[model samples]
Target chain A: MDTCIEKIRTICADLLAKGKVQKVIGFAEGSIPMASRPIAVTSKEDVAKLVFNATCGLNLANYVSDVLPKEGKIAVTAKGCDSRNLVTHMVENQVSRDQLYIIGVPCTGMVDKRKIAALFEDEITDFIEDGDTLTIVSPQKKEKVSKKDVLRHNCRVCTHRNPVVFDVMAAEPVEEQSLDQPFADVDHIAAMDPAARWAHFQELTKNCIRCYACRNACPLCYCPTCFVDESSPQWVGKGQDKTDINTFHFLRAFHCAGRCTDCGACVEACPMGINVRDFTRKLNKDALELFGWEAGLDMEKRPPLDVYSPDDPNDFIK
Target chain B: MNFITIDKKDWTTGIDKSRETYQVFGPVQDENGCQIKPLAPDVHPLMDAGVTVMSPKSVLFPQTQKMLTATLDASIEDHHVMKPVKKDDTPRVVLGIRPYDARAILLVKLNFDNPDYQDPYWCEAYAATTFVGLGVNHPGPCDFSTSTGCGPFSEEGLDVLMADLDDRYLAKILTEKGETWAGACGFDTRADAAESQSLFDILRKEAEKNITSVDTDQLSEKSILDLYEAPFWDDVAFSCINCGTCTFVCPTCWCFDIQDETKHKTAVRFRNWDTCMSPLFTHHASGHNPRGSKVQRVRQRFMHKLKYFVDKYDQGIMCVGCGRCVASCPVNIDIREVCTIMNNYESK
Candidate 1:
């Protein structure tokens, strides 16, 4: 991990010094333990602030659309998930391909801070990471736990561990996992009856406060004005009503049908700890089964849902 | 003031007896995390539940509160006219609320219960409730309440303060409201106030010593324009996703937006918790938004809490340093670090 960080810093610093890019967007040490914040460095001196770790859960692609200067180029330190979203951005015309540089860090996986936070009664004051071992430290006790046990749910089953697209490589690509059950979680929900599925969704969103953090964290949501905020013909209610909360989640998932990269940023950003990926991952499975399609894999073609075709499935239209 | 020594052995029986007189809300563990929910007939409180996922502000200010309701039927008398919905104001007790959160409630009161006009819902709920605060023996790394004019044992808004003593609970009754609830709970083993006060002092000092304070003294002295126009504003707000997570989880964030929803001949007007992080929070009906960009919106959140609140009432910043925003922010937009930047900034 330290070697990966060193490689990332060197690459980003060179980009800044050579005037190849005006800013480098990457992760930095957070104020708290087991947390890392996305940082933007503009000078070579500031590139030392950059870091790469398992705690960098947020997708750096979420910042590309807003943080990029109108004329100057900006570089992003991307993981496998982030690089895919950047491809989505290029396809959607959110950011031009030429003005962007990707510093691809082939990810092992990010750790789920929420999962680790729940294991202790007191605050996690500090921790030491050594290879596959993570030493969990609290004021009461310090215990060693395997990093594999704490890997984020999305990372555990990620098939795309190598960057699909990048301008510079930060490290050698790692081995990607080929899981026996790709969409097991979604299948569990699908196997349930209609009433049971509805109850499942209701339980998942019952704690939602309508914060919209999930929407803002996804790279696919680049609309000037989201449908939720449109008042002329209001689409959804802004309150905590069960119907309203479900509508917002279902609609947002439908909108991200063919574009979502299964990046897990929505799940990571959700303050309520909602695995909102359940809504979008179901669509990802359907896209694979129905159209033999995967999102952001090809830059030359539009998404299956983004285009109108004679061969497109009409069964769902009814 | 008086002290009540609640024996750990008889704690459950006392709380059960109090349930007859008051609707008790306490922290209970669930699938997601511990939540401050109403106690059911079968469920009991998890007194050791530390720093609930959401603050206890929802006790008084619900996330979505229906303020008024109306009917659009032409046959109805005074149709389209809004009327206050009758709500139950049952006597309630919030068990084990953190002292920092209690302090946050008082800070929020300055807005809802000010000189101009009092919010009926908030004031009424506040008047009907008794706050039983629980002092944190060890504050988390995120808590900086001591520097923000609040501490582990600060008793500004709570009626009673309870300190954990491993084997039992030592509760100090601070106000008349506390005594009433204590009596209802059958917690009558009186302890000496002097000894209890000294113990609380020792625990509070130990907890405060653990917290790393962030300075905001320079904010009150610095000109608002200079801080707003500082070069670091863009850099500070660079990674902000403009999500409402920071404000929604915050204990002191009290911005609300009211909207009317008419469905099937019934019109219900509600005031929902709104965040300055949203672009629409300041959007106008004319399609004009003053704080349209993310940078401007992010600036508004910090300036309001750190500068605007200070200038408005000559009080401290409108933050209790509970660290909910610091912990839950998806992008880690820490207010403590932002305060340090604002405090030491000089305009170019």
Candidate 2:
């Protein structure tokens, strides 16, 4: 982790000094334990602020679509999922290929802050990742646990540990995990009775406060006016009514249908600790099963929804 | 004030008795966490449940409420004429609410119950409900109620404050509303009022000591614009994603946006919770937005909570230090840090 951080800082400082990029977007240490904040450093002096660790979970690509360079290109430190988002952004014309300088990092996986918080009795001062073990340091004591035990659920099943595209590689790519059943969670829900399934979804969304953190944190949700915010037609009501809340989540997930990369930004950003990824992940599963298309893997091919084939399954349409 | 001791075993029986006169609300544990919800007929509230994930302010100010309703048909006698929505006037008791959250309802009341323009809906609901506060025996890590002009056992806005005393609960009835609730619950045991008061004082002091102090002495003297335009805002606002999580979870963030929805021949006007974090909050029909930048929106949230609210109401900052935002903010934007920065800000 230290070596990776040093390499990224050196490259960022060089880029800033050479004026290759106006800003270097990366992760910075946060005030809380096992959390890192997305930051944009413009000067070479501040390059040291950029650090890479198990806590760097936020997709830096979420900022790429918004941070249009005033002068040169903008450099971003992209993990596997984030790199996929960068490619999606390029394909969607949210940002031109020339406008970005991608520094890809090979991700092992990020530790879930919630999981760590549940374990520690005292305040966690630092999270030191050493190989397969994570050292949790607090005022009272320190404990070491297997890195896989604390990895985010999505990360544990992640297949793309290496960036799909990059201008420069920060480190050697790590080996990917082989999962026989990637959609075990989704299948669990699918296996339930229809009424039970309905009840499960209802229970899942009962706590939704309509904060829109899930929408805003999504890299693909870049509409200047979200459907929830539209007043002319008012596609959806802006209240916590059960129907209105359900409509908001359904449409929001449908919109990301074929375009979502399952980057986990929405899940990470949700304050209510809602498992919103379940909705999006289901969409991803359908996209892959129906069209044999995975988002951001092949830049040459358009999104499944964007392109239609005559042989496409229309049984559901009927 | 009067004191009564209800045995732990009789807690549910008392609440069951009160059901005849009032619908009960209390801290109920769900998969997500503890939240304030209406008690199911067979469910008993966990009186010792730690601080709820969300505040009980929703009891008075609902997340969404219908303010007025009107018919769209032109032929009707009173067509297109708006009438205030009638609400249930049955008294409700919100039990096990934390003392800080109870104080937050009063802070919000300053906005809804302004002398010049009072909101009848909010005022009426507030009048119909009784706040039964539970004093904190052990303050949460993020709770700084002591420094935010409230304390763990502060009885500023509660009708009754219940302190846990192991096998029983010492209920301090402070108002007629509280007396009514106690009477409805069949709380007949009388205790020495002086002894109970002394015990509460000791509990308050110990709980207050658990919370780390925050510097807020200079906020009253600090110039609003000077603190607003301070150079630290850019850094402070950098990591904020402008999501409504903090505002929605907040107990004192009372901003709302009103919209009229018309369908067929019926139109209803509803007020929903809105946050200053969104760009649409300041956007006008002319396509001009005063707070177009994320930094501006972020700055507005803190300024309103810590500065503008303080200056306007002559009350403390509009937060109860419940720590919901601290725990809820996905990016770890701690309000305590921001409060310190603003409180200590000085022109170079």
Candidate 3:
């Protein structure tokens, strides 16, 4: 652990001195009890402030495009999942590889905030991490839990523990993990009949308030002008009617079919606790089976729908 | 040596050159800042500083347009009264359109003119309008023309291309429509063939400099079909509120819902935008929705953008790479992240 920190610090200092990067986006120690928050460091003086522990789970890659500079280089710390986004951006031409300095972190897994919250009967005041085990100190109690029990779904079946593309490496790369257990919830839901599926959807969207939080948090929905705002032939109503709401949801799902990387940002941002990931996963599965496409995994591959070949399958087409 | 210069002050005279034959619409400042507005002779000054808050789409497709109206009362004789056709035929020019927007208009033409499915409304509007695409001396925050392969010299769907050359605007009339429009301008010195060719070269270079290419190399229709069960969807969809903001804001999200609206004796049919993010979007009349969950809906959104749209249309629907969805989404579910995740998810 000490070696890891030292290597990170050294990389930061060297990158700064070489004038390779104008900014370094990484996690900083959050105030008091909460985990880590995204921080942008510009100078070598702040290199000591960077830290990467089990608690450093927030996907910091989302900030790369947010704080991009017009000129010069930018460095960022990326985990396996975060590396996928960096690669996607490179493939999509949203970011240039020459301008980025990636510091890759080999992660075992990251804990889910909600799962951790549930483990504590009382409010958690502070938490400490010793490797994969987390020691939580709450107002009413303290508990030590295994990382696997509370690991995010994305980390459970992580196929890429090592960064696919990186400028610098911070730790020995970990082997890909395999899940022995079945996704019981997904299986149970998939077994249901069409009528039951409709009931499930009705219950889910009934709580939607039309607050576009999910769209904002997603890293792929980078269009400058979306379709809904067009008035010339006003495609969708701006009102909150049920039919109008349904139209928005269906089209959005269709739009993201092959492109969703399943980071779970949309579900986490939802205040209603709606399991939005289920729909995206189903479509992701379908996209792979039907077209063999996975969105952020490869930088050289064209998006599944960008090109069409006569030999392509048309089973779903009317 | 004589050097003739034309500035903003010369715009009025320039308008006067063809005022008798053409109507012009240009950018004007509104409460929401600059947008394209209807250019009347009286409101010509409004075009000087601001772009219209609304796009030129509104000029062609009005907000409250009546497709057809019907009467259902027994005493009134069950008959329908169709709305009178309103077409703008007097050749009109929309000035100062950024290259990206010109590309958008071009896309509209391609989609609406599908050989399989034709949109009469868009076709009628296209016939009545002649475009005057302006060069982007400065672009807006939402402009992604350079990244999406759209630019000033785009011949896909345009009539006249005008480039801002510091002192005087370089006008390249590509089509006969453009030449006729240019001839009506009555400029003393006609742009020679060499000058026009040079202008095209300059415009192409400018576009190339701004062009940012999205790597669609790994993306294919078959790839999307292969990863339907991948676990990546659950991880990426965690923050989605199931709001249709992404679809509603998307320029290429064309999914719509048709409804019948009634007010007393009149019944009108209306169509509005629909998104795949909402759970209700896939709900069938029989109460069965293929995309009943947030994960399924989120997956559909990406597939449509990266796969399905391209399947139906030969070309990718051409997302202008606008970042509105990144900023406008309330929970900040960035699409860029989702695409990255999709790119990384491995098949079992």
Which candidate should be chosen as best, given lDDT against the real structure?
1
How many steric clashes does model 2 contain?
0
What does the lDDT read for residue B52 in candidate 1? 83
lDDT tens digits, residues A1-318, model 2? 546888999999999999899999998877656777888899999998888888777787878866786657999999999999888888888888789899989998888776786676545667777777889886567889998898888898789988999999999888988999998999999999999988888889999998999988888988888888877778888877899999998899999999888888887887666888889889889998988878888777888898768898756674
Candidate 2 docking quality: incorrect, acceptable, medium or high: medium
Off by more than 4 A, model 2:
A1-3, A115-145, A308-318, B73-76
Q: State residue B329's C-alpha deviation in candidate 1, in Å.
A: 0.5
Please, what are the lDDT tens digits per residue for candidate 1 over residues A1-318?
547998998898899999999899999988788888888898999888998888888888989888778787999999998999999999988898888999989988888888888788798999777767888899998878888999998899888878899998999999889999999999999999999999999999888878899999898998999999988789999999898998999999999998888888998998888989989999999998888887877899889988988988757785
Worst 10 residues of 2 chain A by lDDT: A117-126
Give me candidate 3's TM-score against the actual structure: 0.49
lDDT of 3: 0.63
Residue B160, candidate 2: alpha-carbon lDDT = 94
Which has the greatest TM-score? 1
**What are the models' TM-scores?**
0.98, 0.93, 0.49
Predicted model 3 interface RMSD:
12.8
lDDT of 2 by residue, B214-294 (tens): 888889899987987799888888777888999988999888999888889999999999999998898998989999999
- Give the alpha carbon lDDT tens digit for every residue of B257-323 in model 3: 5555666877776544456775556767676778876678877887677566556665653455544
Ranking of all candidate structures by their TM-score, best first? 1, 2, 3
Worst 10 residues of 1 chain A by lDDT: A309-318
